[model samples]
Target: MITQKAKYALRALTALADADADEPVMISDIAAQQKIPKKFLEQILLDLKHHGIVVSRRGKQGGYLLLKPAHTITFGEILRIVDGPIAPLPCLSITAYRRCDDCDGEQNCQIRHVFAKVADATRKVLFSTTIADAAQPTHSAEVTRLLA
Candidate 1:
């Protein structure tokens, strides 16, 4: 399962995507609109800024905005940035692979075999879906159809 931080990050990004194309959104506005805590949002936005996913502006009209187009920012990218590897098991991780301590060999590990498929399917959906998609009103219906 994705962490709360990851969820918040996605919600925050979706809010940004829904905003005016050239306008930066204030953290307080996002926090209130998305029901995320202001302090936690500050930290999340800072992390996103470091990852180059977002940029912050300064001054009376300053806040935050997506550095790249919303469509270019995938859900998988945000999850990885906020929650680290997307793999269910470390052995299945593409970016941070590590053998399970109790596993003798990956070739014979049934758990790894099953989780590999899970990881692959999860990655496919996450990487294909973007902040632009999530910001749409029909997103939930599309997701339901995909899951069904």
Candidate 2:
């Protein structure tokens, strides 16, 4: 299950991606338009900034903007940024692998094999899909349907 924080990050990111390229957008504006709480969004944006997904400027005219183009930012990157490992099982994880306590030998484990397949398919879709794609009308519909 995707966490509420991850969902909020995606929403904030897509909102930033939808703005004019390289244009700074205020946190208040993003929070107001995206319906994310201001404090929560501030933290999310800060996390994104640390990940180099976004850059921020401070001052009267300062705000936030994407560090890279939306088309260059994959959903997988953002997901990992907020949620960590994408694997359904730690044994199947590439970044944070750990043996399952109940498992015997992973090599012949039926459950691990099955969940590995699930993780692979999910990873492919997420890693290949860009934020620009998520922000598109048709893609947004598909995402909503899938999440629903």
* Cα TM-score of candidate 2: 0.91
Please list the C-alpha lDDT of all candidates, in the order they appear. 0.93, 0.89
> How far is 117's C-alpha from truth in model 2 (Å)?
0.9
Candidate 2: which stretches are off by over 4 Å?
138-148
For residue 112, give model 2's deviation from the true position in Å. Answer: 0.7
**Which sections of candidate 1 miss by over 4 Å?**
138-140
Candidate 1 global lDDT: 0.93
What is candidate 1's lDDT per residue for 1-148, written digit by digit as tens?
9899999999999999999979989999999999999999999999999999999999999999999999899999999999999999989999999988898999999989998998988898899888988898778677556555
